[model samples]
Target: MLRPAFLAMLLAGISPHVLAQPATETVPLLREIKNWVTGCDNLRNCHALSSPSGVDEEDYSSLTLHIFHQAGPEGYLRLRFDHRGEDLDLSTLLLDGQPLGQALTRDLHVELDDEGGDPEMHFYSVIEDAPARRWLQRLRNGQRLQLPGDDNAKVSLSGLSASLLLMDAVQGRVDNVTALARPGKAAASEVPARQPTPVLRKFPTAPALTAQEQAGLAAAAIKALTNTDTEMKPDAEAGALSADQAMMVVRTDCAAYNCEYEISSRERKPPYTETLLSIQPLPLDGAAFEGSVGYDETTGTLSYFYKLRGIGDCGAGGVWVFDGKAFQLREFKMMPRCTGSPYGDWPALWTTLPAP
Candidate 1:
C-alpha cells in the first residue's frame, strides 16, 4: 500500500512527457526559411517610405535604415533607405509617423546577399531565447503566436511609397519595439520590439489653401497613398477634387515633374528645351507614363507635355509656357542631362537626401 499523497506526486511526475512534441518541430522549421534581399538600393529613398534618402536628417549626422521582412513576393525580404524630398505628393510619401512630403532629402542605396536557412534560429535559440524562456516558465504560458507579424505598408499617396522598412532601423528608432512569441519560437529574436520612429506630424506652415481646397487635397492625397479609387460624382471636382487633379497641378507646377514640359516646344535659357522627353518605365510602354509640367513663376504660365516620343538617357532644358493652365505642344523641347545614361533622374537622384 502507498500513501495517497505520495501516489498523487508520482502520477504528476509522469506527466512531463505529455507536452514536448510540438516544441521540437516548431524550433527547426522557423530556422530554415532563410533570408534574402528582395530588393537593394544604395540610393536615397531606396525603400521609398517618404523618408527622403540622399537628404541628411534635420542636420543630424545619424542616418536611418529600414528592413522589411516580406517584399514583392511572399517569403522574401527587402531592405531600403529613405532621406527626404520636397513639395511631395501626398498620395505616397510618409516618414515615421508623420508626413514630410515636400522636404528636399536624399535616398540611400543598399546591397545584400543571403546564404539560405534561417539565421533566426541561430540568434534566438542560442541567445535571446533564454530570457523569454525564463519569463515563460513563471506563467506556464505556451502562446502559439496567435497573431501574425504585419503592417498595412500602404497608403493612398501617389507621389511617394506608402511605407518603408530598413535592416538598420535598429540604431535610430527602436523605442517602440515590442515582440510577442511562444515557448521555443526560434524566429522570436528577429521580431524587433515596436519602436517609435520620427515622422512629420505637423504639416509645414506654408502658404495656406482655402478650407475646402485644403480638405479636398488632404483627402485625395490620403486616398492616393492608400490606393483607394473613387466613383467621381460630378461635383466631386467642385467641393473636393480627385487625386488625379491635385497631382496634375503638382506635376504642372513642380520643376522636377515638369522637367520635360519646359523642353517640349522651344528653347529656354539653352541646355533646356520644350522638346524634352522623359525617362519612362522600362520597355517604353504607355502602361506607366512619365512626363513633365512647367511653371515659370515669373511668367505665371503653367503647362504640361502630352506628346513625348523618344526614350533614352537624356535631360531636357526649360520650357516657356504661354498658358497658365495648359502646355502647348509647340513649346516641346529637350535638354540632355548626359549621354548614354539611362533616361532618368541622375543616378545620384537614386542616392540619399540632403540634411533636412
Candidate 2:
C-alpha cells in the first residue's frame, strides 16, 4: 500500500486543474479605447483617464475623471474627479441628460483639495468602491456624461466600457467576481497573482568637486560636444560620478521653442575619453525632438523629460540611477495625448521599487 502522502499526491493529480497566473515577464502597456486611454504597469496596476484630446484649449470648465485599479485579490478600485473652474453643482451631473441626483453627489465624498496650489481652487473628490461601481453601471447605457450647469463640459462615454474591460483583462480579472466590466461567478482566487515590483540598488553619490575642477570637466565635455556640432555653445552641466568618473549634459539644439539636450560620461581629468549616452524609449516625435536630459549630483540620478507641446500637458519622462559602474533605468512614464492631466499623474511605462 502507498504511503498516506503518496496517496494524497496521486489523488490530487486526478483533480481538475485551476487557472494559473502568467509566468512571462510583464511589460508596461498603453492602449487607446475610443474616448478613453488606459495603461497598465509592470506590476499590473492599471489607470484609465478621460482623453485629453477631447478637450479644447481654454476649456477650464471641463472636468476630468481618473480611475485606478490594482492587481490581485486585495486590489482596490479608486476614482477621482478634478475640476479647475467655478464651484460645480454636483447634483446637476447627468447621464444622457437625466440628473444623477443627490445620492451620487453625496456618495462621491466630494471635497475641494487644492493640493497643487493652482491659482484656481481645483475640486478633488474620491468615490468609494460601492458608489463608483453603481456609477459605472449607470454610465454603461449613457452616451454623454454631462457636468452640472456647464454645457461645454461634457465627456463622451463611448469608450469607458471598453477601457474598463481592458483594465480587467490586464489584471487577469475577467470572468472573476472582482471584474469591473463584467462580473461572473468565477472565484476571485482564479485571478492571476500580482507581479512583484523590481528593486533597484542605487549607488551613493561621488564626492563633490571644486569649482575649478567642475569648470574644467564641463569645458572638456563641451569641447567633445562642439566637435560633433559647430553650433553648440557653453550651455552644459557637469557633475562628479566617482573619484575619476564624471558626467556632462550639453544643450545640443534650442534655437526655438523646446530645447534639446544630450548626456555624456567621461574621465574626470585631461584626455576626458568622453562617451555619449543614449536614452531609451527614444523621445516623442514632435515638440522637443531630442528631448532634455539632466543630472542631479546629490542623488546620483539622471533624468529626461519630453513634452509634446509647450503647455506640457502631455509627454514622457524617465529616471535612471548610477549603480557605481553604470546607469540603470528605475522608472518611466508617458502621457501620449495632450489631456490637461498633471505631469506627475502620467501612466507608468516602466517602474522599479527601491531597495529597502
Query: Mind giving the per-residue lDDT tens digits that candidate 2 earns over 59-152?
Result: 2326777788888876888877666577676667887878887776676756655465655445555556777777777777788777866765
Residue 147, candidate 2: Cα error in Å is 1.7
Q: Model 2, which residues run further than 4 Å from truth?
A: 1-26, 52-61, 111-114, 226-234, 275-289
Against the true structure, whose lDDT is highest?
Answer: 2
Q: TM-score of model 2 relative to the true fold?
A: 0.83
Q: What's the lDDT for all of these models? A: 0.23, 0.68
lDDT of candidate 1 at residue 191, scale 0 to 100: 35
Stretches > 4 Å off in candidate 1 = 1-37, 42-265, 268-274, 277-349, 354-356
Over all chains combined, what TM-score does candidate 1 have?
0.17
